[model samples]
Target: MCSGGFAKCLGVSLMPLAVVCVLCNILLFFPGGTTVDSEHITQQVWYFGGILGSGVLMIFPALVFLGLKNNDCCGCCGNESCGRRFAMLSSILFAGVGVMGAGYSVVVSAVAINHGPQCLTKNGTVMKWTYPFSEGDYLRDHSSWSVCLEPAGVVSWHLSLFSVLLVMGIIQMALCAVQVVNGLLGAICGDCCGCCGEVSM
Candidate 1:
């Protein structure tokens, strides 16, 4: 195993990471989780829960692979090809999400800087970031919630994770990338035997 190899990744890693993600989502709701809609059953069970869940599931295998390949546990399973590929691609996709999510936050922050956060009136309910409008009328109605979008001195947990995730995401991408290359190489190598369906047209 070379340095920084997938050998170090194990399914156990998934366990802890999943726990953290789920915990974060739980905290997010009480502490306030972003409310939106998305697709995928990702680890986080809100907004984009499905997508996040799928992403976590996909990445989980990489860790499992570590257990199988590196730790000599669960050797030579069935249908590894498709599962491995799915996991690889999904991991890359999920991890890459951090980049995109942070991009939105950055843009929101910039807009906030330009124009103060706007107050919004939905169902005649007032919602400001810091000061809760709970059941009150939105004093500052129908404008840019840009300030609310970005809290002052606010270090977003997502943003902070984004930084860390970028690195981990890169590693995940690289790992899956290599796995993809390996898969391709394996397929090509297998078919190159030149006996099954090679017809020179």
Candidate 2:
């Protein structure tokens, strides 16, 4: 395989890149695992979507590489027309999801910069104090009990991870754009070759 060849380079490069995507998602799972009500939902969704969408997008390269390796021309599986259609549909969906992920990453980064660190809310009123100091502490101090949101940790790392995911999302979107074009071409070819009925390319 010529290193200079576009197809060869893309196929070879994607396999390892896909692995990196998978690893990044796994790491993101920890911080993005839980969600709180209110504004936290949106924040969590963005982070989660950014991580998960990239994972879905990674599958496209593998499918493309397999088709290339087999000289299948269009379809992810083989030369079958139906397979190509499926690949096209999948590409469209993946691309849509990737776009969402990218948007999510951007929102996260922007919010982190403008709003600073995030936190979870706890209703202090709901909990019954076991000791007099706990229950009467507020009374003794003449302080009022209320719900409070406390910062879990700094979000610098979270922002950094989302930045990586954003890049992946953009790259995946471009790849899927190509897949959409390939799918259209295959569909046109299939229509023209209806009489021959030979899907192999």
Candidate 3:
């Protein structure tokens, strides 16, 4: 593997990861769709936007990495050619997407906390999944206006999963930044400094 091979690996890995995260986030909100809650709509939009943005941002770099792997050409900078420059630019874009995704994940986690539908039990009582409120309060506030019956635990679980994915995205972004710096070093120092040159990672 060349110096930017690690970056190529990361870009390849991130594409599928991003796809999974996007699906999970969308599924997380689908259960709540029956309710006309504006908050829920906003949450879904943010999740979709951020996750999809990250995934889309990764494609160009991933393609560039593939080109570098197959071309076997050397450009002005090093043995890898213009692929390094393209990788740097794409990594920077992915980093921005990752930051936005992270912030959006925080919002999703906050909104999802104790937020669920009010359900009626066989015992003639209603309950909702809300925090800071006791079971007694949950049983009492079962408003008739609520249309859906969803388990709070499931929604919470998906939200947690999505949050974890977002954290992973952030880490990938950092790795991309590291790759950018590595490429920059290689461009500046060339073969003089082995740290950034065409060496195996």
Candidate 4:
């Protein structure tokens, strides 16, 4: 298959993944489907991992990849093949950007999962927003989840959403990595079967 077609397929697959990351991040702001003060939310949610990292950053690369197929240039010093190669080469930079973004999201999601969620918990007869779990301790002990007095099941909510983000981030990273290789191959070989223009009979 032509490199452009392969890139287009990758781009199509990335779009939905990016959307899912954004949606998951947004939902993280509202634990257990209930709204709370912004300050009470987990700190990691503020990092905008899924929003900026996975969602926005991934969108750029996806769009670039999608357009690569139609980026057939005809008037570049009368070197259409050279122009196509350059276009593919340029996509490598975008793929690198995507890798970085996804990596950021993965890091943030992992940290958030480890730190657990911030929720109202009783401390010596006083209630305040605090992280009840220490470094993923709550993941093993479900009974400890009672520490979070408000937001109702916030621990589970946080874990689920952040886990989704982590998985999606990893997937995004893998896809971008693949694009890096694809871009390199496209640059080295140019588009296959006269992908830039119709073959002369």
Q: How well does each candidate superpose onto the true structure, as a TM-score?
A: 0.35, 0.45, 0.55, 0.91
Task: Name the runs in model 2 displaced over 4 angstroms.
Answer: 1-15, 29-47, 72-116, 119-153, 186-201
Q: Model 1: how far is 171 from its true place, Å?
A: 3.3
RMSD to truth, every model: 11.7, 11.7, 7.1, 2.8
Error of 2 at 11 (Å): 5.6
- Give lDDT: candidate 2, residue 173: 54
Per residue, candidate 3 scores C-alpha lDDT tens digits across 66-184 of 34444332443435554555554554454455545544544554444334332322324745332332223333454522333343343334345555555655655665566566556
Sorting all predicted structures by lDDT, with the top scorer first, yields: 4, 3, 2, 1
lDDT of each: 0.35, 0.42, 0.47, 0.89
Which portions of model 3 show Cα errors greater than 4 Å?
32-50, 73-149, 190-201
Q: Give the per-residue lDDT digits (tens) of candidate 2, residues 1-201.
A: 211123334445545555555565455444434433445332443454444445554555545534433433322323454554454344345445444544454454344334323444344545421112222233334222221232232243344555565566556556545544544544444312432344443
The TM-score, computed over Cα atoms with residue i paired to residue i, of candidate 3 is 0.55
| Deviation from native of the Cα of residue 118 in model 1, angstroms | 11
Highest lDDT scorer: 4
Please report how far candidate 1 places residue 197 from its true position, in Å: 26
Ranking by TM-score: 4, 3, 2, 1
Q: For residue 190, what is the lDDT in candidate 1?
A: 29
Alpha carbon lDDT at 167, candidate 2: 62
Candidate 4 clashes between residue pairs 3 or more apart in a chain or in different chains: none
